[model samples]
Target chain A: MKMLFKGTEAIAEAAIRAGCRLYFGYPITPQSELTEYMSRRLPEVNGTFLQAESEVATVNMMYGASCTGRRVMTSTSSPGFSLMMEGISYMAGAQLPAVFVNVVRGGPGLGDIQPAQSDYFQATKGGGHGDYRMIVLAPHTIQEAVDLMNLAFDLADKYRMLVTILADGMLGQMMEPVEFHEMRDLRDMPQKEWALTGASDHKPRKVTSFDIDPYELEKMNLRYQATYKKVEENEVRYEEINTKDADIIVAAYGTMARIVKTTIRMAKEEGIKVGLFRPITLWPFPYKRLNELADTVKNVLTVEMSYGQMLEDVKLGVNGKANTPFYGRSAGVVPTPTEVLEAIKKIMVGDLNGR
Target chain B: MVDKAVDKVIARMPKSLSGKEFTYCPGCHHGIVHRLIAEVIDELGIAGKTLLVAPVGCSVFAYEFFDLDGTVAAHGRAPAVATGMKRALPDRIVFTYQGDGDLASIGTAEIVHAANRGENITTIFINNAVYGMTGGQMAPTTLLGQKTTTTPYGRTVKANGYPIRMSEMLSTLEGSAYIERVMVTTPQNTIKAKRAIKKAFETQIKGLGFSMVEVLSTCPTNWGMTPIEASKWLEENMTKQFPLGVYVDKTKGGN
Candidate 1:
């Protein structure tokens, strides 16, 4: 059954359904509703909810809870997310599973509470102090955000890495009908022998990001690289619409893709033959599919709520095979459908280049 | 050689210890404290259900020293980590071993907030007045008029600031169930320190509240003194600045 739910609350409910009982977070705009929801709802299900001292403590708390082999998650905005970068890096290195929801707000330095995709580079390019990648899922709608929380948790545990739900402020605050799957049984979760349960059943178990010996650390890095490679191979997800017969395929994600879809219809009426390709997984970006599209399509246009962060991946996919043009707005600006159509029209007229 | 006829085991290591040789400096009290905690866990028979959260200072490798399941948290984040562990597994006993710099300085916010919430966890705070792991750097618990790497000319009220008394400060917070300050300079004091640590854990086991024991430790390597001198200096100078005793006792007050 579909229920009318606010975006943030739906994400919280969906996480509870996904067997995530331990949530540690602090309030931030556009995402505070999620934390508030967990605070009220978690206790009904015998879950743990804690408002940590700061985002630094919040992420570290999640890290600690995750070590006990329980599902954990948190939500924050841009500045708070930045504070969590250090802990996120540690979580990634320690091979812990956790989910983070960044209801992205204007950034660079507390620009505003308005929606923006400014944290794309920070999310995809390892914002913290090491070589790590968080499987970033960009959900365009509230229902999708609800659904991706399950994927976020599953992928996090499966890969023993971080998975982030990269939603902008618009999607976080927007209301929509959301449907949840059956509740997951935490008891059904496979036992992680490596977790620090106790020494009674076996020898002492240890988990840490610390491998002081250079050679031992290198070996751990090699193992991490293997997991990342496996993720890249099997977990690429995207949605392509009207792309088979289109002359131009616009690459966008998150809420921006919703606008691009409208632009696609407008361009269709104008005989532009524009298509839409929305990446569901932003980190394991649908690069190979875009490469194939470049072979058949003449122009590839990229639209974003930020200043062309994901465009780099689009460029990497095409690799000089086709003309890549970009149109982006930042600093809390969401480009309209008409503006996207205009960008598509310019790409068709050969007046734009992917710079 | 098994000398069952002539020898009898009097003082032996606790089963909760990992049997690994400690890497702490000579005369360092971390070794003594580690044994004290292990003894408490052994006595309580909670080794199978106890989890240790090691800090990022000299005890960063403390997870390896304990037979209990454990992990290492970043510098000054042990309180938060312990908070997570205890909240997730309330049946499992959770504790953190932290240094003066880890608990009093960088992690002050984490420790205060965790205690303020009354998390059911234990913290073993080693206040050696210097950053032991980082090569004798000045710490927030460094006594005034004492010299160190950061406060080369000696700690002063104006230049550096007054040393933090964590036990007294945290005892005031309603969340804390038991808070105590002790030292392990001599045999008598070591026994008293063990009592304090055991009481702290007992507080957690009783589901009382947050518990901690601030141990006044010696840093002979950093203080430019011999092991024996460091112990004597702790008794003479450190004891005057930071007194030893129970600061809070919720168990006795029916709290």
Candidate 2:
């Protein structure tokens, strides 16, 4: 049942297979196909599909549905995702398990419908209030979009944490071949010990973020910090290409990463020993891998759709060990391979000048 | 047959829920409304099967009062939360309790759309003419020429706004399966209010569609009077603007 589909549809199909029985969301550009696909498919399987009146309502619905131990999800673009911040904070605070997909578009606010990676800071820094972090997976291709969604659900259930699939609008709109997996057996899935299912004689399970006691809230914060420590230690994932003995490395993610892969190949043809480091999980940020690459690579050139947001992390990873330069294209434009190759040449010249 | 069902439901009220004590100021209708819902949940034997989504305003702390699985929603978003709860667990009885300012002002879109979508859920809306929690601010339901904090000069169509007849507005929508406006200001009306609540829940049980019972409530604190004065006020001025009695009853018609 392999078929060519848009990245958004691939994610939706993967979610349907992951026992995601409830979906509450609003339609937004670059990701509307995902909701449209769910509306057409969910009812056939007796799954819940609700087009919420607004993004704010949709996310709150996700909150309530998630509270009931159902595999719930919602998808939207940058602007819509912003409107969902309050509910996202609630989900994070309650330590609820839910999956959220952000097909990012340009903006600080309603910038444009075109593809953009400007939401990198918002996604990585926890888009909502209070002290919390969401497990963020960055998918470069359509196949990864499908694959990551299943993994997102599992990890969300396992950690009782919010999981996010962060992809740009271009990746969402582009068509690519995606592999499908066996449908997860809902009965075989683990039962949520914390969800509000019934009010029988057993101990009542309260699903809430409110803690009037300072000590209890403090303990919750420490637990979250400890959890993030474990995620940083065990959950960091990335891809390496031509870094075996390469002199220069180009770090990117999502569409920019794919473009960097092609640019590295072009650079190699031109007798420039360039490599690529594509971070798959942007939240755990793959700092250790970047540190390892810094030991061998003389220069690291970071590229993205937004103007140098992730480059800051690359700099921290390099930690003054190498000369790291950033190149960015903004306002609905993706950087082409030629542009990245040109940036690589500039970085190489800068590297030679330092010698 | 109706009497039997009501008696069975009345028997299941949890002891944890105070059988009589209430913090709602005297003549305030919230105590009556909450009691009716708790009684109905008990009567239907759905106390354990129901998830009560509570709204902000006076009922913000309803989680403390209701013995059922309760979730607190932000202002005006209780219906959205209840919609999510209902869709996620089709077997559970999910309902939202909201006040006029919460439902009509901030949450109007959510309530209207949830009903229009015919979501399998119920809404218990309490319409008190003045905003009680925020100190007697003029609410969406504040009648013309009514005076309050912001409308000290009286709610004027020329200066302030007209009262919103929410139940009637919602009854006109095709998505409304059972829409009723009841008053809890008197015992006779209290019986009608309970019947409406029971009918709304039954509609959810049948999986018919969206059902709502808008209860005309009282706010003595905001009305510059005692609980008795507020109840009398509700019977007098508020009823003239909001009105009572069932706007639409489709329970027998089966949606």
In terms of lDDT, the best-performing candidate is 1
Q: Scoring model 1 with DockQ, what do you get?
A: 0.85
lDDT (Cα, tens digit) per residue for candidate 2, span B1-255? 666656455444454354434557777788878888877777788877788787888887676687767677877888888888887888998889999999999999989988888888999999988788888999999988878999998988887658888898888888888888888877888988998999999988988888999988888778788877777878888888877777776777634
Clashes of 1: 1
Whole-model lDDT per candidate: 0.91, 0.85
Local accuracy of candidate 1 as per-residue lDDT tens digits, A69-187: 88999999999999999899989899999999999998789799989999999999899988788899999888889889988999998999899999999998889988898899989
Worst 10 residues of 1 chain B by lDDT: B1-10
Off by over 4 Å in 1: A351-355, B1-6
Best by DockQ: 1
Candidate 1 residue B136 Cα shift, in angstroms, is: 1.2
| Model 1 / residue A123 / CA error / Å | 0.9
Best by TM-score: 1
lDDT measured at residue B201 in model 2 versus the true structure, 0 to 100: 95
TM-score of each: 0.98, 0.92
lDDT of candidate 1 over B1-255, digit per residue (tens): 545755777777899989999998888889999999999999999999999999988888899999989999988999898888888889999999999999999999999998999999999999999998788888998999888988889999998779998998998899999999999999999999999999999999999999999999999999999999999999999989899999988988567
Model 2, A105: alpha-carbon shift in Å?
2.0
